[model samples]
Target chain A: AQSVSQHNHHVILSEAASLELGCNYSYGGTVNLFWYVQYPGQHLQLLLKYFSGDPLVKGIKGFEAEFIKSKFSFNLRKPSVQWSDTAEYFCAVNAPLRAGNNRKLIWGLGTSLAVNP
Target chain B: GEEVAQTPKHLVRGEGQKAKLYCAPIKGHSYVFWYQQVLKNEFKFLISFQNENVFDETGMPKERFSAKCLPNSPCSLEIQATKLEDSAVYFCASSQGTLGGQPQHFGDGTRLSIL
Candidate 1:
């Protein structure tokens, strides 16, 4: 079965520290990668996505992710973090559909980040 | 600015009661998906539909959970005889296509609390 894995369960850092969250998928075929963030009491929003072309894709709120095909990973990164960036992050992959079924996203266990000022 | 809309931001239900949730996919989107989040953990895909047809329901517990996406009507998820373990946030998402490589747009989830 296809699955997505996030290494970090919970992370804490002082403000202005750099951030990197590792994400890996088990599928070997062409896939679409996505990063989503959910702030407290807020809806889940798309942070970034990687479909094709450039491996490094930039997204809103100074977030970016690199798709490394050889490693089967698409890790999210931020150069510097702020208290406002504290949220739960989820990595998802869209694998190709089999016959008679629509494509669905395989999600990783979310990582909760707490940024201290 | 495409957005999927969900109704009933919060719901409180008693054991064995029925719970229903609704979702409206973004305009022009043909694919709808339902997911359940327990304790803010990984999202469990419950069901998906392409247009008015059921595409995938392997994750759904068919014993009590049922869902439908009718043409010209909002999609709905209904659970008969809810259990305490059913307390969770349910999210709806929609995409332009049902095939691979389409990023799904999510809606504000409906928080269901079963007592």
Candidate 2:
């Protein structure tokens, strides 16, 4: 079984401040990592994902997450966050490239980010 | 289209009553998943259906939780004799099954409140 953990429960930041949210998983084999965001009343949407190739994966809204396999971390980062970026971000993990029944996602508790103007 | 559609944005039910949630998966998608998000806890996978057949239901509480997906109809998750612990946002997501590089499309979720 695979599990995901997000260290931050809540984060407060001022506009233009940099952002980083830590995510780690417990799977030793190959895995897929994802970052999803939910705005005030919006549905959860995919921010980025990492499967293979480059360790650094860039997503929409200037968000990027780096996959550090050795550390078991895929931390989400943004150089400058805007007020509109205040939302709940979740880190999710899935088992490696199995043909079937391996695409189920295990999600983290989510990190609430509040960017004050 | 919004990819996935979940009905009754919010639902309120009394204990010992029944609550039902509906999810319409995106066209051409064969995989549908249900998850519950309780306060202070991460989203827990409830059940998953590949087309009309259930693929996995290990996370679903067998005693009180039941789900079904019919042909040409949206999938439904029903809770019999609901309890306070059932209060949470239930999300429905769909994907292209066990394929490569496909992400789940989530709905806004139906917030279930049991009194």
Candidate 3:
């Protein structure tokens, strides 16, 4: 079965510290990668996605993710962190839909980031 | 509209009672997906629809869970004989094109508590 993995379960960082969350998928074929963030008491919002060319994809709120095909990884990064950036982050992958298969987003166990001021 | 709308932001139900969740996909979106987020922080895909047709229901517990997406109406997920373990947040998402490559836009989830 295909799966997504986020090695970080919970992370705490001081304000202005750099942030990096690792994400890896098990599938080898073409895949679509996405990073979503859910702030406290807020709905999940898309941070970034990688569909095709250009392995480096930038997203809103100063977030970016690099899709390394060789490693089957799409890790999220931010140069600096703010208290407001504290949230739960999820990494998802949409693997190619095979015949008789439903193309669904396989998700990782979310990573909770707490940015302390 | 870009936002997918979900109704009944919160629900409380007794064991064995029925629970229903509704979702309205963004306009022009053809693929709709339902996911269950348990307390363990893992998302379980429940079902999916492409227009009025069921695209994928492999994750659904067929004996107790049922879903439908009818024309001109909001999609619905219904659970019969709800169990205590059914307490979780359910999210609905939609995408514009085919399921493989399209990015899914999610809605504010419906939190269900089974007592």
- Residue B22 miss distance in model 2 (angstroms): 0.3
Q: Give candidate 3's error at residue B28 in angstroms.
A: 1.1
With candidate 3 superimposed using the best TM-score fit, by how many Å does residue B11's alpha carbon deviate from the native? 0.9
Q: Provide the lowest-lDDT 10-residue window in model 2 chain B.
A: B95-104
Best by DockQ: 1
Candidate number with the higher lDDT (1 or 2): 1
The DockQ scores of all candidates, in the order shown, are 0.61, 0.60, 0.57
Q: How would the docking of model 2 be graded?
A: medium
Top-lDDT candidate index: 3
Between candidates 1 and 3, name the one with more favorable TM-score: 3
TM values, all candidates: 0.94, 0.95, 0.96
lDDT of 2 by residue, B1-115 (tens): 5479999999999998999999999988888989999993479999888899988888899799999989999999999999999999999999885764578999989999999
Instruction: List per-prediction Cα lDDT, in the order shown.
Output: 0.91, 0.90, 0.92
Regions of model 3 farther than 4 Å from truth: A99-102
- Candidate 1 structure quality by residue, lDDT tens digits, B21-88: 99999999989999999988869999999898888888899699999999888899999999999999
* lDDT by residue for model 3 (B6-75), tens: 9899999999999999999999999999999999489999988999999888899969999999999999
Order of candidate numbers by lDDT, starting with the best:
3, 1, 2
DockQ versus reference, model 3: 0.57
